[model samples]
Target chain A: MNPRDEILNRLQQVQRDETLPPPWQSRRDFPELAARFRQALTAVKGEVHQVDSLAAAYDLTNQLLRQMAAEKVVVNDERPLPNLPRLPHITYHQVGQEDETLRAFCASADAGLTSADAALAETGTVILTSGPGKSRLASLLPPVHIALVPITALTTDLFTWAASFNRQLPANLNFISGPSKTADIEQTMAVGVHGPKRFIVILYA
Target chain B: MSNPSSATMSQFRHSATVAIADIQLQGALTGATNKFVNGRITALTELPHANALRDHFKKIRSATLANLAHYLELFEERATTAGSQIHWAQTGQDAVDIVLNIARQHGVKLVTKSKSMVTEEIHLNAALEANGITPVETDLGEWIIQLAGEPPSHIIGPAIHKTRHQVAELFSKEVGRPLPADDIDGLTAEARRLLRTQFLAAGLGISGGNLAIAETGTLVLVTNEGNGRLVTSAPPVHIAIIGIEKICPDWDAAATWLALLARSATGQPMSIYTTAITGPRRANDPDGPEEVHIILLDNGRSQLAGTPYEEILQCIRCGACLNVCPVYKKAGGHAYGSPYSGPIGAVVTPLLFGLEEYAALPQASTLCGACKDACPARIDLPRMLLQLRQDEVAARLLPWRERKAEEFAAFVLGREGRMNFFTKLGRWGQRPFQHDDGLKLPVNVGDGRTLPSLAPKPFRQLWDEGAVE
Candidate 1:
């Protein structure tokens, strides 16, 4: 028998006294989903700001772009992101416009902007998917990452999120709680090791 | 057993003594483990129904393992449907050969890798290097150890044993520029600058999966450093080397298991990034790996099924047991001399490897049951350790002196008359080695252990005199 057959055969020979585990139910109740989300996000050194409207969020993005002295940013060619006004000084490129340029931009880009599919309140996590316009690297490969989330996207936790998760999923889905960090060096917490250092979530109605 | 393994018991004793004596290593080990233990407590206690979740998760792991082959077949079908090619390796050599063949076919010269204990166990980097491929470990801790020409000391924090001054020196050598010892942020920046190019330029990327979900045929990769994302996405071709036992039946089981994993390991509600990769990049997808290969490695894992050691297969590599282990805290990770360390390592290593060679590891623990308490899956590590020790003794791995001593102890302890005689004998014999609290005997029970001196009067004598009323 080949390796697969042999391995599977060995495992199959074992007598199983198995009981199916109970299905997970969401008993976690967050009184204020958005407030708890902000607190959890902020605790991990991520920034969260609540804006009244999408237009105000765009305005805040512009202000943040200027404040951070960002010269170039990469954004997913998706809704809300495409609505951001074009600024002359700060060049914004749609991720995956050109494969070569996308890689280069991710290498040199100062910030990445995309809209999260869902946000979990308990851990302050954002769910991002990989699809036609949503490049996996858009939220990765930058010093700073800015996410646009709506108030309605907030869920209780991962268990709650998975309970209602769509059966037809994307090629990739990421549950990111905070900025990329590491405590590898002498157990010292160092932020922004690989991905974005500063994760800013702009929540709008 | 190899020549190196012949002296396993003595080697463990020697290395443990050295590790305990090294003040710097002792400080790093205790400091890191205490922080992890404290964080795990805080994270688990804060969550609602945390204990219930753990119990449910344990059932999930057990059920999944009981039907592992079935779930693996299911995962293969779904992953294949999602555009991933699944390969099974019966041994570490088979896994390494398959990976080399993939790298060869791709003509891959530079390979970027996320930190993976499975890869470490198989010695993938050595194979890649021998085949003229440069493998770069992207995780900071893994990279530090890779640069230092040492194996990972800890499974989670590979470089936890290294001090900042030591890391700075390694960084300085790598970059050919002196970096400040105290500035960790600056060092991290240098690593980013260094590894970013590797991720972009590398032709192939290799990673280890935390779990292979049979529900969607998804591979779950969890990391706090975001290296998993880059490794899987940056390179054109991706390969994930997962152990056969690392599986969850479906999304529901996976979700519950994950809830406990992060808390048990890092005390975070979630790691920075928890990615579920179904397949290679879709046709319209903007950016992801074009080809994804999943290698399911058995390598002695399947043999443990239905055996006394089957519970060890449920380990998630969370390193929780290491944090709370008293032996691990003092001896540190390097003393174990394997990919795994601490309480879990003692059982898993010997079971995966041979008990005769790693017999000493089973004796490394104090059988304090801290590991079982800290375990997310609630694996009975202490019970398994005792089993392995029994197997070792059965195989006559114990030295003649030790075996004879044990036999003599059994003879005396089994009979009341003999026990009384031996208690008096021990009391008289222990006088020279006796200290304030216990006996300071020259003999080592495994490592760094002390025996409490015998009582002034045996229980039999005290009872007869009515002193124990």
Candidate 2:
């Protein structure tokens, strides 16, 4: 017999209790979502800047980039950052460029800026999906990642965030809670071993 | 390519004895397990309705396992529809062969791995090396152990048994120069530099899925380091080996699992990265594996269905049980002499492997019930241990001396008169061995453990004299 059939047949013989308990219902009401999200994100070494407007968010992004002394920046092409003031000295790698050297550019880039698809307030996680003009490596390879998330995108938790994706899901969905970190060495926490060392979220109203 | 020295179950007692004597191993285990235990407590305390969430997670796991075949078939159908080739392997060798054939067809020279315990259980690395394919472990801890040519000691922290100095030596050999032993940041930087090139160069990436979403045909991987992302995204070809039990019914179930997993394991609300791969990269996608293969491996798991021990399949490999287990704390992961260790290992290893081979494992536990309490799924590991002991007894797998002792004890306890007679005999017979209120046997016989001295007078005797009333 084929291994699949044999295995399925074996599992078929097992008795199953047909009655399953109801799925877990998460409480979605969080009046202090911004505060909660900041607290959770900060605990994992992620910085959250809640701006009153998109203009403030753009200003903060430029301010943060300057503070980190970042020179090369990679921005995802999904949403154009038209309002953000561009610095002449800073080199920018725009997404959707046909340059095959994009991988190397991302590896060498100092920071990656992208817009989050959704945010989980409970865990302070930002969800990113790969699609047309959104390079997974842009968010992954750079040393610093800055996500521009709107306040409306914030949900209670993973369940609520997942529920919003009732339509077509992307090929890949990344739920990133904090900067890349590892305690693999003697239980000592070290950040930025592989992914972005610094994760900055600009939450605009 | 051969199995590690500690792979055999016969070495369990010897390894455990050695592990107890090794102060470094003891300290490492104590530090790591304590951190994890404390973190889990803190994480759960901060969550609202954490206990209810765990209960819901348990229901999801139980329900999924009950209808495992249906979920697996659904996952296969959805995955195939998403342009992924599905392969079924009933045994470890079969899985190894399937992977090797894929590698051969693609002419893959270097394979990057991202910390899959299932791969360790299947001994895939050894098989790959035997076929002349260099399998590089990209996870920092796994890489450390790989360089040292040793089996992983802990589930999450594979090289937790090794100290910084030992790691420095192993890494120095790899780099052909002496590296700083105490500098953790420097070490991580060096590892990142070395593994980055390998990630870019490797032809194929093999990872283990944490949870397979049946509804969407997605494989979820949770990792703090970006190695998981690189392994699944960087390489041209990607293969995920998953056990049959890891399937979740739908997105809701997957959400519940993701909610509990990282919190239970490392006390993080979520890991740094939770990557969900639906399938191979589409035409519009810029980067990801072009080809994706998922190997559904049974390897003794199918036989566990409908059995009393089926709940063991609900394990998410969170390693919480190891943190709380008294036996695992002392004996360490190496002592279990399997890919898995600690309480979960003691039960599952014997069930998946053979009872006679892992006879010593079930006996390793103290039946303290800490494992069950720590488990996110709330698997009754102590109950399973008791059942395994009963199975051993019924199978007559115990030594003749032990069997005789049990039989004699049963015979004595079956009757009140015999019990009283033995109590009197034991009190009198233990006099010669009594010292300082404890029985002091020879070192070779007792192995440094002492039996508590009998009571000065029997309770029954005192009751007969009306003194107890």
Candidate 3:
């Protein structure tokens, strides 16, 4: 059997073991699916405001990164400091073709753009998974990473989140909220010490 | 051959003891953990249904583990479909052997590695070196400890114990010249220059997965410095070693895990770089590894299925428990002397490697229940620790001295009718053992730190004096 068939089979097995009705089978059609999603989105309403369109989100991330740089939150001087501006300098390179993208994006950009899963209003987190075209580094290697948000990807809670997910993703899926950070230092809140200090949700029109 | 592991553990303890007393270590640890704990608190507070979300993940983990075999099979199939090769190892050594074989097949001489604790568990570096291949650590923290020839003290902050001065010194020695003062930028520059060379020179790259999706065979790597990207992309052949239990059945499930992992660890809403490697380079692809191999190691994790400790496998290894653990704060990871250290380590070490070697580890905790509170997957760590302690006692592993103390204490408490007499007598009799501050006289545990002070007055005395209503 192919991978899709195998995944469906396993998911069916889990449903059977849990004695849960097949979620898809129980729903009559698209209307029910839409209703379920509506409920999920409603639950995540408070978190929704935190999500911004891609461009605006990048601005927010850059602002945070610049502030952190000024505060000496991160101590890397080998790379040129990112120059803050109203808009993030956008660059596009095919996933595998570009090696400089990782370095240029890591050292220079405020946030790198990639595709996103539905915007989660509950946590204000944008989801990205690895696959054929999306370079996994585009989401992670920058100072402040942003993803172009898809409206349809929104979920209210974790269960709702799982419902939207394909049982088998190609290789990797990452759910990002805002910025990369660690409290590994003396428990002081230092942004962007190791990863992006700020993460932003970019809602695409 | 000498037992490198035991010797390593001993040396680890020696360094940790020195680190524990170091003001810098204390400052870094206190600062990092408190910020993480407090930030998570604020984030969780902001989420209206945070408790409900925690419950949901618990349900998922329970349900998932119930039919894990099915999940694994599905995951293997999906991963294969994505043009990835998946191999299984029954043990750590088996996992290492598989990785080594892959390295040899590719004619790998020098391997640049991102930090993977799973690889560390099997002593992959030493094993690879013994076989005549060199593995270099690319993460700044991991590289420092690698130079120091020590195990990581803090999982997330591998070099948390090392001061900036020490880092500069290490870098200076490497360059055969005195570097600048202990400045963060200077230190980072030295590391970047050195590791950049290795990244370009490496024949293969090895990494550990933060999460592995069964649905797509995607390997998720969350990093800050962009090192994971390099290690995965720089080399022609890439091998990722992950524990089988790291699997989440689908992207949605994996995303939820990431939500909890990011927030619980370091209080990040999202990690800077969460890399997902799907398969080897596609026909049109330019920069990824030509051959991608993912080695999934069961290594005793499967044995945990259908057991109460099954929840332990749900851990994303965020080190949140370690951060909040009071015992861990004092004793540190080195004192635990296991690859997996802290609260999770206390439970997992005995389970994975056997309790006999790590008998002291479970006893290390004060049953504070902080670990349970800190767990994102909501693993009932305190309860598990208690169960392990009972098992120790049942198995006659509890020290005779402790058993005797318990017996005497039980006798005193059991004789309720004579409690008053003993209470009065004990109060008077314990005077000689009391210190100036009314703490018990200092007695040695294995560690050098002094025991916490005991109370001067028993609660019963205050109650008798009508100090309590």
Candidate 4:
């Protein structure tokens, strides 16, 4: 009778109340967390850019990779764009170099910088996570993603980022929030189907 | 898993009378349920307390279904201590033989799914194409109803009854030429270059859990076409299945059920990927899925736990009661033929299939109450569609002349002088079926619909001339 003990003995003959209720807090307050994360990440087309430091978020990530005429980007090496200023026809590809052609260079890259680990401002979202040198396909398969964040990593939603998790949790986290849409046609929307169609972020401060 | 004779009642009244004489399935079910009821009423009126977060997500789904076997044994012991591999099934052919024996012990030819109404309620792509394996469906409206083999008329727009010239004639017969049917961005860039090489050459990805949590065993998913993050991160074996009533109980009830599931389905305060996962890929993770596997199933949902339709297991499939269903806006979603259609598939496909094959899905609803006011977990669902029409007339399952006209109208409405002698013999037997004032009867009944007439002067003859004290 082991279908997991016949469904835990039919949920222990209908569990009466093993007491659980008491976690849902969110009254939802924002007090301008980066102006409500740039108005919920510019109403989901994303592209925030606030910048006040990290060298003006590395000069708006090299002016949004020369306005997306990108060459071959990639990035995510967990915080190290140091003395940056290269741009001799793009080509970056960082993420801790364990490389086996880093998933076909983040699937034929055209963009995919990174750095966020939190930032919700009531659903503009951007958590990320995945571990060591990041790279969940460098913010997923790239058509343009960017990220950078750190305005003390926002958070006023997804229940204050699952009440700021704990005991070391990263093994694929994500959240994301824009660019890679699809109204499943006839409902219309259509942006990059698989992932990034350009998300950007660069909050800084 | 063959059940699909479109859940009978003469194929739901011949597909609800050909979906009410199809004016393009009533303008694609009134423009996709009026754009998901005006984007779930502008994302729940810009969400601040949104009805106290749907009454705290209906008290976190009725306290996670009353300790659902201690949160599914703490989600199979923290998903087997965060490495995954859980299993369990118990029907729907033991969850399609535990995902076809984990795709025949990982030799899995091609899998790639994602956009799973519990794998279309366990048909599991016709048992993985009758064990030959192939699957595919990478979301763009379940790959336009899996290249038009059909089924999936709409539980989240599964080809919202196909049109864009029938999805450019089912994607020009899956790319063998002739494509442009008003090019929706050239048909989503030819379905993103054919599902990005079937998410980088599938080897098993499956997917289907929208919320499973049990304090960090995790699972989540959501999506908006990153094909649930390339079917849980580009396959190397993933699995998922789900539905032991989507357990919750932690991470603050999976953050109030992901803040009312993409603002009650597609209003999108979220869903452009939510992901989550929590196991199988931890060794300094670079990518994910190094064999995850979840399953859990329990096909009829463990006989719906302390029943009273256990709040229809607090559904979070979030089609928002098929966008405020007026009988799913004129019998659409393929006329509730079931992989869940409107009004929680008319009280969950007749309580998980049977009440004599979905007794015309609780008589296809009209009890209104707009699906418990577009349920976030409000779920009365017209009191479970009047307790499944009193369990389909205590299982006599109607029609003996509609149970003798509902037992002679409940014995003349339980007698007040036989309800005023059948209301003065239905006003003298409907005065020879009055014509211009309305009841043009002579047996056409309701095909053309008029039957109104009975009020002409009989409020008991204007309350015996007191007219209306």
Candidate DockQ values, in order, are 0.82, 0.71, 0.16, 0.27
Candidate 1, position A20, lDDT: 76
DockQ, 0 to 1 scale, candidate 1: 0.82
Point out the higher-scoring one by lDDT: 2 or 4.
2
Candidate 1, position A125, lDDT: 94
Model 2 residue B79 CA deviation (Å) reads 1.4
Q: CA shift at B445, candidate 1, in angstroms?
A: 8.3
Q: For model 2, how does the per-residue alpha-carbon lDDT over A87-205 read when each residue is reduced to its tens digit?
A: 77799987777636667888899999999888999999999999877889889999999999899888899887666678366778899999998898899999988888899999999
Question: lDDT for every model?
Answer: 0.90, 0.88, 0.65, 0.81
Tens digit of lDDT per residue, candidate 3, span B142-169?
Answer: 8888887888876677766666666667
Q: Candidate 2: where is the Cα deviation over 4 Å? A: A80-85, B1-10, B428-445, B449-453
Docking quality band of candidate 3, CAPRI definitions: incorrect
- The best candidate by lDDT is 1
lDDT of 4 by residue, A13-104 (tens): 98786465677677877788889878887887787878788887887798879976899988877863535565889888777676557778
List, residue by residue over B1-469, the lDDT tens digit for candidate 2.
Answer: 2233232344677777788889988999999999999999998888788888888888888888888889999999998888889999999999999999999999999999999999999899989999999999999999998998888878888988888899889889889999998999888888998998888899999999999898988889999998999899888899999998999888877888998899899999899899999888888787778899999999999898888989999999999999999989988887777889999999998898888888888888899999999899999999999999899999887877789989998999999999988888999988888998588865444466788888978888789989895
Chain A only: TM-score per candidate:
0.96, 0.93, 0.52, 0.37
Evaluate residue B364 in candidate 2 and report its C-alpha lDDT on the 0 to 100 scale. 83
For all candidates in order, state the fraction of native interface contacts they contain: 0.89, 0.69, 0.23, 0.76
Q: What lDDT tens digits, residue by residue, belong to model 3 across residues A15-40?
A: 43652122221111233332443333
The DockQ-based CAPRI class assigned to model 2 is medium
RMSD of each: 2.5, 2.0, 8.8, 22.9
Q: If chain B of candidate 3 is superposed on the true chain B, what is its TM-score?
A: 0.88
Interface RMSD of 3: 6.9
Ranked candidates, highest TM-score first: 2, 1, 3, 4
Tell me the fnat of candidate 4: 0.76
